[model samples]
Target: MTPALLESFPPFNPEVRLQPPAIERWRRGTGTDVEFVHVLDSGRPGPTAMVVALTHGNELCGAIALDTLLRQDVKPLRGRLVLVFANVEAFGRFNAVEPFSSRCVDEDMNRVWDDAVLRGARHSAELRRARELAPFVDAADVLLDLHSMQEAGAPALTICGMTDKSVPLARALGQPETLLVDTGHAAGLRLIDRGGFADPGSDRQAVLVECGSHWEPASAEMALDVTLRFLRHLAMVDADWADAQLRVPAPERQRLVRVGEGVTAVTPEFRFLVPTHHLKVVPKAGTPLAEDGGRLWLTPHDECVLIMPSRRAGMAGQTMVRLGRYES
Candidate 1:
């Protein structure tokens, strides 16, 4: 959808509970020789894993977690650990009064991941940053792209791209109570779905963690907890170090939700019949969920779970939400 279409929708006002951390000290990274990219190598043979933050400017939880990691001087024990602050230019423009307005400086960074878009002539603040970070992302064996939600009170979720490789990894991290397996966005391929990360046969894997609401302090804690667990899972960081850093206990169990279909807006007048949160379940089939134009959107099956229901103004072909079912 176009920026004009997004602008047409009324802005959502979420309560701000967490203050954005000052990231000026991390502008010059210690490793990789790239700005805002730090790489710590143990000089031993193991998988290289990368944890990324700030894919969207306003998602402060990931940034805060990464910043804390940097300050703590966390280092890898066997493999390489790469910490990246993506979309710094957009993040530089973040204003507490108008947080959502600074999500990107040009186009959405997450949407410009396809090879054609990166190699093509299109230029933007986000594209340039992604281009610089692509080599690092492409080289990693494991990746964790941290993000947060727009909807208030929505539970944390792990978006494990349409494959089972990342499912075990998500389950191992054990935070964010819900694991969603789905194809990447229709708008574009995300970093988690790029190259080997999306290839089922390949050993590479990536998971996008939507920690919680954007401005919540708990979201930042969740981000750090998950990141530490991820590093521990890869054997990049010592278990003792990870345990010391963890703020909350790992989840007792995780519910896996496999998305069956994405509900894209076919008409401009799309509206949900009920207020939905992430992972909200409808117990019966044919239940009215939304309306688009004169058409009523109904649940396709019993126990249909709603995933990431949109709060933004609906544009034609924009994903309003996704329908899924529990696997375990």
Candidate 2:
């Protein structure tokens, strides 16, 4: 399906960067060591925060932002700060010029969650690596898994679970396009959403930060700003950080929807409308939407976030569309 949707997914073949001195490479479920960034401040013990990027190799925006942050010489406040370069091998295969492939390698990294697979024989290396990052998520006050999504979309968006603790945090850290993707399915489980066996202790918070489409400058910049704002939101950094980037002013919390179980299939030759990442919505009578493919396919009837179809089209369900309203 994916192969037919777009021409082909591309991979970037850049030379790998050596590990930094402060960062450590540790082995977990994955036998080989992957680099993890851990900064501790026992001087004044406080809450711990873990920021992870590149769960999906193709989602490179977050990786750039985190790598940039790590390079910045900054001191931690009261609590400790940990940064992880979650998936390096998959990221290495990234090709900003192409789509689909950027998000993953052999299998989607985000969809590698399950008790059976976790307990499955030594399967794909990515599956093992995911288990390795579990401890980092468990030890934090907040977990921000940064990622760059497909489609030339709006401001930063978040994928959160159904919980008051999660809701308020998501709302508080609102991005202008505060799209509440119900994910009719839960986070991480969907090949698109990527579920994790992560823990949710009491009110611990986790967010899948979709920075922007791959390679776009705006996507990269937004990703960098949001990571810093997150530090302030968690008090990991101080006013200094906020004062630096206008601090993504209180975002206008917009429409929220459930990423329900509706399937949108596309033909092999489906191409995105160029110039802008715009996908036209074709709706049917007595039906919320319809497209001319013989008969209109029925859609979920409700105020839902249309997973905006990308002008850059792919196979069906490759992308979804939505018209978000201003949340007063």
Candidate 3:
């Protein structure tokens, strides 16, 4: 099946210029080799912000961002910067699935960042890189995991803002227009938890940002600006970093259709295949969403918000599914 996402940026030559630094290397699993680009700044060493990309093979926005980030001349004020262009093999796989090939080569890379799997020999290349990057995480303070989605929605802020400290950062991030999802966990642990650290004893602030739909050319540029803004926000970048403000466009807001339920046919363009029917409703539960097996199927009784209604992608399920929303 074709993946409803895409991205494109120039190649990044780490050695061509002075990058943060290569702190370490992890084993790249079968048919894959991985390397992490680690950079350290002692100018005013304070907090550490680790930026990672390409956890998913097909998610290209982050990859493009990494290319641009690697090439940029960023001098930090305090703390350090860890820039990683991860999952080389999965990322290198030619993704031409649908809109592009579903870039998921082995399995979803983001879903398998478990320690038990990492210690074993059965894990994939991504898992190993996640484990390798774990240590650098402990040495620093912040982590920004970049990603994209399958549908057309506002460039969202999916911060794993669960802790007291991280919550403030996430809240700051989810400002004028943003949705905060408290994974009911800490900020920097599990890859999803934002607490995913290499060193267990270190303090870390982490958040995952879904820039926009896959294949957005502008998404890469947006990521660069946001990273710069984030650095300034953290006091890592120069106080007067050039144009470090990044905001969502008002028109982009209209694309965020507060995804209702039911099996609304998903067109490749990331829009509803047909006009929305009376099948689903937002902020409401137990409502009939769509027809399955020729009968009215209802939504689960919960405060759920949907995103990226896909008819295909995962195995055996309904034609479409709902994404859990961030409770304000």
Candidate 4:
């Protein structure tokens, strides 16, 4: 009775440079309804800023970033700061030897944020947590969900859902040069897209930052950097302290890539034709990029950029890569 994730695929043993912090110390977080959730109120009127980590159990960088903040006793200067360690059930099972196996215990926690799924009769470890976490997420005026890529050496990026509001904020954060503007996933709605954050008229905004490779030491640093930038942008933390804590320089300019579509693996035999360590562009239309059980994925137009090409090859029904193009 082995978990599906533990099933063998291609061998990938990347160096685990960042260690998962001892989170048990933060278990009874501020007496929140859910464990590992802390709320820091500044006792002044302002927007509620939420920062979440461990959306996926295997992504250690976010956990590290949140842990660092907790240890430092970071407090919001203007309003409430809600810190969450999501998917702790799955995260509790993390093992560097078989890292990906703990991404979730039942299903992806992120994809369970849809209203139907959350209110539905369906049961899963992720959905249950999402239900417990929904209220805090709904209460936020802004949210930053930290994550990392599955592939090593992949460049850092921010996932600004097909929303006009988030892009401007991401541009302000500056680092993670690539900003991916995408439609909500076909699988399910993500936490960032949930509630009023997705409404055009709503002031609330959410951004998901893909820090870097999951186990890379640099990813943890980038995670913290983004968290600081997010707080600084919202004027949540002390200006002097946040500025001193910042490590990565803001990018000179950020590029926005609007995702056209995601290439889903229909079969377990899907394979990409090229190495996708970083973002790539197919120079011409109709060029074959991948094949899955005789079905070929061809570029729809020239200069099509491939985003976040996955390392998990044998997983069917998952998005292998996203097709997008740069603006201007």
Alpha carbon lDDT of each predicted model: 0.88, 0.53, 0.50, 0.87
Query: Who is ahead in TM-score, 1 or 2?
Result: 1
Q: How many steric overlaps are in each model, in order?
A: 0, 35, 27, 0
RMSD of 3: 9.4
RMSD of each: 4.0, 6.7, 9.4, 4.3
TM-score result, candidate 3: 0.67
Give the Å shift of residue 257 in candidate 2: 3.4
lDDT of 1 by residue, 124-160 (tens): 8999999999999999999999999998776789999
Q: What TM-score number comes out for model 2?
A: 0.70
Off by over 4 Å in 3: 1-36, 96-102, 161-165, 174-176, 182-190, 194-203, 242-283, 290-297, 300-304, 313-328
Per-residue CA lDDT of model 3 for 232-263, tens digit only, reads: 67877675653443544423221122333334
Which pairs clash inside model 4?
none
Model number with the top TM-score: 4
Q: What is the lDDT of residue 66 in candidate 1?
A: 94
- For model 2, give the 10-residue run with minimal summed lDDT: 14-23
Model 1 CA lDDT for position 47: 85
